[model samples]
Target: MAVVDGEGEAGLLELEDDEPLEDEPEESFDAEVPLAEEPESFGLASARASFR
Candidate 1:
């Protein structure tokens, strides 16, 4: 019973930690993936052509 109670408390703490991560994925998807990809694609092509 004591071990079960300790595990339950740890699970609740993990849930609290995870709540913020759930919010961050939205910005990560938008800023890291799409936002980064679009500029890199266009800028890299322009840079390559300019270099050659």
Candidate 2:
């Protein structure tokens, strides 16, 4: 069994002032690196293979 607490609510209130404005542009999750410049990382090759 687990105990419930009000501390979670308090922490949320503390962070509410730091939240981003709704109008700000959200970041894109797409590749930050250009296809030609991507480093020869291990899993990157397999991941790119699946995309095509």
Candidate 3:
């Protein structure tokens, strides 16, 4: 329900159906929640954190 924008929403949509995320909905939700609430800046931060 927190999916608010096209980019954040699209990432979740793309990853949501992947077999790797089949049971990891919470992970995606957590990442996307902040993305929806914050600006694109936070989205970039989250991406960097994810890579770290």
How many residue pairs collide in each prediction?
A: 0, 0, 0
TM-score of 2: 0.22
- The C-alpha stretches of model 2 lying farther than 4 A from their native spots are 1-40
Reference-based TM-score of each model: 0.35, 0.22, 0.32
Q: Model 1: residues >4 Å from true position, as ranges? A: 1-32
Better of 2 and 3 by lDDT: 3
Poorly placed runs, candidate 3 (over 4 Å): 1-20, 39-52
| 30 Cα displacement, candidate 1 (Å) | 4.9
Give the alpha carbon lDDT tens digit for every residue of 1-52 in model 1.
1245547787677778787889888877877787778898999999999999
Cα lDDT tens digits, model 3, 16-37, are 6686667789888988988687
Overall lDDT per candidate, in order of appearance: 0.79, 0.54, 0.77
Clash pairs detected, candidate 1: none
* lDDT-better candidate, 1 vs 2: 1
* Worst 10 contiguous positions by lDDT, candidate 3: 1-10
Per-residue alpha-carbon lDDT of model 2 for 1-52, expressed as tens digits?
A: 1234856766666567446633332332234444435655646898889999
- Output the TM-score of candidate 1: 0.35
lDDT of 3: 0.77
